[model samples]
Target: MWASSARIYAVALKEIKQLSRDRVTFAMIVMIPLVQLILFGYAINTDARHIPAGVVDYTQNQTSRALILAIEATQAVNFQHHYYSPQEATDAIIRGDIKAVLILPHDLERRIALRSNRLTQDSARLLNEPIGQWLVDGSDTLIAATVRSLRTMPLNDVTQSALPQTPVTFEVVQWFNPEQRSVVNIVPGLLAIILTMTMILFTSAAIVREREQGNMEFLINTPIRPFELMLGKITPYVFAGLIQVSIILLVGHLLFSVPIRGGLLSLFGAALLFIFASLTLGLVISTIAKTQLQAMQLTVFILLPSILLSGFMFPYQAMPEPAQWIAEGLPATHFIRMVRAIVLREADFLVLQQDALWLVAFTLLGILLASVRFKKKLS
Candidate 1:
């Protein structure tokens, strides 16, 4: 019995050793997840506010000033920079500097005065009130509506005057992805999707690949423990994941100019936790799958739900209570939020502890399930 046990232990040891030498697997494990984190964090943003606006006020009259004051007071929009000339404001909009531009014609005050004068002359005044034109960036519909509804009432007394010489005022505000660069937000989200998709998919496939080749039968017949087998399979991935991370970060910073606001230590810590959890999930899936096709199919099923329900593409808070609860349970949901906070907000550990704990729990649970199933599969 003692000799047989020793042989079993030796087999497990060899498997662990063999895993250390797989360079392709190692690179996949390390480099892929890191790239995803950088890409996803840059791409996803829900809390879009403070749009850039441009103003071109030809009126400059007291009536137009009142309208401008109303816009400034509403707090819905902010004038980032103003152009004295209408041509400059239009050019800025075309160049993507400003999302929306406000144009006040020279006759705006005169029109308002004319309408007011007409209203006073007859109780039922049939005067044409010239509608002011507000040019908005068609890209952000929400911001456009906000800019259009700055004020409803006219600023000056229309009954007393026919209208002023300078009647119109221009105010423009930029909306969603206001920096006007699509890559800034999309790149970060790509990092997350790539990391989760590639890492989980390949890791799940590795075990099935070995089994199909009959290598798993020889290793299992030798008496290697389930935990050891699982660890051996995952160890190579951990190293690969780290390498992929470095390359992605380098590319995002150098090529894309995506900023990394948080401390390297904190970001890496969060990444390790997420990777461990994700890899374990793959292991669990592999244990349940009888063939490589089955494993890939299962991964696809899990991937779609995780991506959709995880608040990656949409806001979890906006969903109904049932959907919200489902989102809360997904590891991707928390990871997405964690990566974004780290990159954008530079959140401290205290702020991110909840997500960290969740990832740890997920990894532990997955490891336990995979180990039990792995033992059965081998037996």
Candidate 2:
């Protein structure tokens, strides 16, 4: 019994020593939880605040200005632009410059006065009248909800105080997603997250695993160039990415009834570029990582920000400017924007040219970096 106990203790101590020596695994085990806790706790916000908003105050009266101030006071909207026309406000929303637009009707004051006077007899009629309009970029469900809640408060308060029993109404025109279905927004963005996570992990592990098993050394001695070798490794995963994309899209449509309102060809084209970018990014990570475990740790490090900062779970605009700048550099960010534009807004290739160009640039940059890193690591 003493001999068996000694052997068991020795094995346990040996395993602990091995774990200590594998610093990447040790660091990951210790740091991943801490990192996730900090990120999710501090960075992720479901209650959307300070949403960029444009106001088209046709009345331009004290009443309208006061109402705007009250809405801004709610801390939900940051009224940045005061446009002359509703067309300008709508254009801003479509351009992704603002999330919500408040249009004060020309007869807002007059209507309120008339409604308040007639409130005692026909309070229900007051609710039917369109006092103003709130044009929301409903593609983002959280922002829309926040804006809707905020916009109604001032109107509701004024109506209650003036009439004591009636409620005011505004036309909340949700531009892209009228129904405000969460699936319409989430399903498309999930494509970017899924592709980024799977492609990066697979390719990062592929190269590191080869190196770990001594196959990379054999390949290094072969006639294939480093760039070509990198391409060969990434090529197979592109098909795998496409397969995953198709499955997710099909499942999203069948299960969640998420609509693909845009052209399939354009979506596929953007997806192809994004997949190549993610795979090459993995190759770059692989070159830096000494082991599959290290590669995976680096992959998770990249993925967490991609999920958080890429506007996957939260509005990109809501994050601080520095975080937005970081998000702009991520392929997942551009991919999410492109996918949402395509799937929710039915945006065409012409409309999405800049996003496509960014994806192309990222893919090329990733390939270049991967090739350089692979050569340096090989030597």
Residue lDDT tens for model 2, 1-379: 9999999999999999998988877887888888778667766677777898999988987778777777787788899999999888876666566888888888888777765666465544665677888999898998888877854443544543643544455778887888888888888999999998899999999988887787867786778987898899999999999999899899999999888888899888889989988998998898888888799898998898899989989987677676778889999999898888877777676677787898888878888888887862344
lDDT of 1 at 278: 77
Give one digit per residue, the lDDT tens place, for model 1 in 1-379. 9999999999999987765665444444565565456434543344333456677778777776676666665655567876888678765654445556666778775566555444465312424333365566533334555565653544343223344432223343443334545454445555566667767888899988888877776785776788888888888887776677667777987998866776778777777787788789899988867677667766765676576567556444334456657667767777766665565445554567888999999999988898888753443
Q: CA lDDT of 265 in candidate 2?
A: 91
Per-candidate count of clashing residue pairs (backbone under 3 Å) = 47, 0
Best model per TM-score: 2
Look at candidate 1 and tell me the lDDT of residue 78: 60
Error of 1 at 218 (Å): 1.9
TM-score of each: 0.55, 0.86
